[model samples]
Structures are given as structure tokens and as C-alpha cells.
Target: MTDGVPTWEEIARDHGRFLYAVAYRLSGNDDEAQDLVQESLIRVRRGLERYEPGSLEGWLARIVTNVFLDEMRRRKRRPTDALPDDPERVLPAAPAADEVYVGLSDDIQAALSALPEEFRVPVVMCDVADQSYEQIAEALGVPVGTVRSRLHRGRKLLREMLSEHAA
Candidate 1:
């Protein structure tokens, strides 16, 4: 805790990596993840005073998620052309671990990206961000049962997509 004011820079310094993880899992790209984190920081700064003490990480993750969802809504309203990309240009550097495992994560991200926003948000909140059903429900303004069903369906779809890619 620095002097009196809780600066966004301090929050970014402490929680940037976690924010990046959440953003990356949601957006599936480095640039979008960075933008999401940046936007979340801005929102956090505006609301920092009202921020409660417990689960700061959770609060930040929720902000990132909200920002991402808002962008998705805006994009839907103003559809843009998606430039075709060369596969080579899109691929990430190889990870240190098993190639198959790394590819699986990429596959999961692709599948997650393809899911409906409702399913995708809950699944990422519960599975990727490690939030509980109650937290996910609250963040999504839904019930626990709704969150559970969405997560279940999301995981099932992800499995099917990954298996098809493996074949």
C-alpha cells in the first residue's frame, strides 16, 4: 500500500499479470488482452474509492470481463471487417512444455471464443478465473444454476471442438 491514494499504476504493477491472464483467456490475443487490461485500469481508477477490501483480484477480473463484454456489444453494433491473417503471423512462439499441450490451450481459446457470450463469460469466469458459481452468477447477473448450466455446456462444446481439431 503506497501513501494514501491507491493509484492505478500500483494496481497494474501488482495485478497486471493476473489481469493479462484473464484478458488473454477471454480475447485469445496479446494486443486485445493489453487493451482490456488498460481499459479495466481506467475503470478501476474511477471507482477505486468505492472498492471494497476483500478479493481485489476478483474485482479486477470482473472489471476486465465487463470491459471485454462491453467491447463485444459495441462491435456487434458496429460490425467491422476482419482482415485475413497468415497462419505464420498469427502463431505464438513455442512454449517450453509439450507442443500438444500448448496447441490444446490455443484450441480451447478458439473454441471459447466461438461460444455465445453468455456461455463464454461464465465458463471463463468459473474455469479460467477460478471464481465460484456464486461469484460468476453475481458478476453475470444470473442465478447459480444458470452459471452451472452454461459452464457445463461450454465445457462440452470445448471438448468437442478440441477433439475434432486433434483428429
Candidate 2:
């Protein structure tokens, strides 16, 4: 196995930064991005014994992608009180000062944020998160049936929300 620690460490040192960019896009913050990258390395390690040198980068990318998606699922599966329900939840938890004036029209991000965990996770995984249905199902530990249903419902809600503006 070619110096076990070096192989994994080498992989991480070489590719981890690139993967971290993808994680940050998925996670929306640096702290969570680093955590996801580190966790992705762990996952890649477990599968290393079966490593095919030809697809090493693909393998690493899959691990990074899955790790970020898994974090989204865990956040969704948590209790409702993961954040306070209060409207005045304050900045940081509330939108940042710049977001106060210069971000999305507020309504769209607000609508997305307001969606239930079941709908939100699937929607983000499909649209914004860009994870495949199979990947999403594996990360969320659910059937593909569940993923498709949730995605359909989530899209319908977003469509309705957007239509309100059209009307």
C-alpha cells in the first residue's frame, strides 16, 4: 500500500484546497468549509485500500461532494430549535449588515430560509447544491423516491413564490 499515511496525506495536501472551494460553495462559510474538507479526507481514507490510481481525483471529488451534502442532511435532520424561531434573531444569525442593504431582494432568500427542512434540503441539493439524486439519497439515507418527491414539492413551492411576483 505505498506508505499509507503519505498517500492519504499527499492526496489531501494536493487536492484538499480545490475541494474546499466546492465545500465552501455548498456550505456558504469558511469554518464549515474546512470541516467538510477534513471530513472528506477521512471518508477518502476509508476507501483508499480500494483506490484505483486512474480515478483518484474523481474519487476524491466524490468524497468531498458527498461530505458537504451529508452535512446539509445532518443540519436538516436536527431538531427545529437548531436556531431560534424569533424574527429578531439578530445579525450573523440574521442577515449581515451588507445583506441588510445589498443582498438578494430578501424575499427570495427569506422564502428559501423559511421552507421546512425536508423541502429546503432537497431543493438545495438539486438546484443550488448540485448533487445528483443518487448522491442526495445516499447522503440523506433515503430512497430515490423520497428525493424526487421532495424535489418536486420544493420546486412547486418556489414556483408559487416566484409567481406571486409575476401576478
* Each candidate structure's count of clashing pairs: 0, 0
Q: What TM-score against the true fold does each predicted structure earn? A: 0.80, 0.49
Model 2 clashes, total count: 0
Deviation from native of the Cα of residue 100 in model 1, angstroms: 13
Q: Write the per-residue lDDT of candidate 1 for residues 57-106, one digit (tens) a residue.
A: 78887899899988888877766523325567455655435323455677
The regions of model 1 sitting more than 4 angstroms off are: 2-6, 80-101
Candidate 2 C-alpha lDDT tens digits along 1-167: 37443377788778776677556545554556678888988877787787766645545556776776666667679856346576655234553454353434455555565666677666765665456788778766799999999989887887788668657
The best candidate by TM-score is: 1
Maximum-lDDT candidate: 1
Question: Candidate 1 has which clashing residue pairs, if any?
Answer: none
RMSD values, in order shown: 4.4, 6.3
